[model samples]
Target: MRQNPARRNALLDAAIEVLADEGSRGLTLRAVDQRAGVPTGTTSNYFSNRADLLEQLMRRVRERLTPDPAALAETLRATPSRDLVKTLMHQLVDRTRRERSSHLALLELRLEATRRPELDPTLTRFFTSDLDANVAFHLEAGLPGDRGSVLLLYLGMLGLIVDDLTVPEVLRPHGVDALVDSLVDRVFPPADHHGEEVVGQG
Candidate 1:
């Protein structure tokens, strides 16, 4: 049977909502059907089992979370040097905030990756572009081999936001800037306060 694109996406959207509200354990066929306003049988027709549904649901998330290479390159090139890395960091954090349901889905998969190492490789590969983009910025700041640090900062931002959401004014005045700088030091060990760079081919 020919599936309607609109209906298919609606199902994926509903799945994200479900996963966010209740986590992976609560995402059931009946719940998805109710959220999509489609029949349970229709969902089964598309995804025959829980594993199949979970895989496709994550595939949808990958489509949403995976950074677009062109956009990444454009941002890296166009942004001004002064505070540019910090600005890009904020932008990435903001995107995750905007599609928070997607972030929750990513977190759920990340937890699963702990037990299933095979899954972790593929999952981490999906997020590599974002990590590499930040690494390039760190390299420009004179912090070579800083990919691990940038990834740590990215994760830190996630944790910060989670706390901020759960608790009001947790970071105090000027705290965020201090935290961002601290992140840079911890991750990009050789980061110079002021540095110059050539427009990198990479």
Candidate 2:
């Protein structure tokens, strides 16, 4: 019910932290209030209930993870190629690492969604729209891939992120950057002289 955008955003940010640190079960108005350093009942004033808080947190996480428009525009100016896709993937990995808390909170929200059927539709919509947008972007940019390539890239990067965040040790030997490069190379392999994709080529 509160109309103060800044305060509401602060509360949502705090909720993200709480979700990351304590999981969904520990998310409560009092916990958010303490995390945000606000007075008791402050969060309740902003969020109607636990479900409302979770929904808002999901939106906030998306906002926090969005790519920088200026940087994206700069990248788009370069010729579209596998290198360009690698650059974008690197940026995504870097952003995910930098916004560790938000990403972790996102994982928590996804897990919570499994138990709360009411959340399925919202999460599904968000993921589906994001995938569609990504596919459209790749096609428009003339990237070296189709919808299937984009989907594979998405799944590969998602797995990389999960492993990088949850268990870096597993990938430390291969290195995150190397793994990303490998993922991009495999998903968007170089084309042959005839402009046909060469799959499984060394």
Candidate 3:
């Protein structure tokens, strides 16, 4: 049982690894402590119970899984708007590929959230806030899409990432980059030459 933030984060990372490999059924406090290579009952020192551990795990995963706004800003600043969308989508694909275990654990938490009604409020707030921030980001960047369109793009990316990560063959043939390009073209509709309206053939 350590009060250190580093130790706490280490435990959470261990929990993610457990969840990714063994699913929620195997995410016991003892299991987490063992996975973290800490003393027995150490998880209980930080997390009061299973629910608390899960809630904190969700928060931690959200923090790690989301895109980096500052980096995205720098990227968008250097690239054309149409290309920025592709770049961001490619980032999503890259993250899913590189962080497969974390993403899988995130999916496990999502399923657990469905069973634990008490988690809804916290999860809801997290998702709502994230969506609002994303919408604001797109608008601030002068992207050619309203919040609804932005949201669609978000969902599309999520679905693509999940499918590609879980079942790579489905997307490997066309390539994630090409699929993302098509998706961005469909949802974003690149700006016209005259800067009046979107003008891209789907």
Query: Considering every candidate listed, which one attains the maximal lDDT?
Result: 2
Expressed as tens digits, the lDDT of each residue in 96-166 for candidate 1 is: 66777887776777776786676766777666755675567567755333466557766887677665444
Two-way TM-score contest, 2 vs 3, winner: 2
Q: Which ranges in model 2 have alpha carbons more than 4 Å from their true place?
A: none
Which stretches in model 1 have alpha-carbon errors above 4 Å?
Answer: 66-74, 79-82, 112-145, 161-169, 172-178, 189-202
For residues 1-202, what per-residue lDDT tens digits would candidate 3 score against the true structure?
Answer: 3399999999998998999999878999999999999999889999999888877887788777777779876878764476777887788788778778888987886787798878778777767887898889788878667888899899998899989878889988998889899998888786678865564576
* Model 1: lowest-lDDT 10 consecutive positions: 193-202
Number of residue pairs clashing in candidate 3, backbone atoms closer than 3 angstroms, sequence gap of 3 or more or interchain = 0
Better of 2 and 3 by lDDT: 2
Question: Which runs in model 3 stand beyond 4 Å of their true positions?
Answer: 66-70, 191-200
**What lDDT score is found at residue 127 in candidate 2?**
81
Candidate order by lDDT, highest to lowest?
A: 2, 3, 1
- Looking at model 1, the pairs that clash are none
Evaluation by TM-score, superior candidate among 1 and 2: 2
lDDT of 2 by residue, 1-202 (tens): 4379999999999999999999989999999999999999999999999988987888898899989899899999999999999999999999999999999998887898899989889888878877898889889999888899899999999999999999999999999998889899999888889988899875
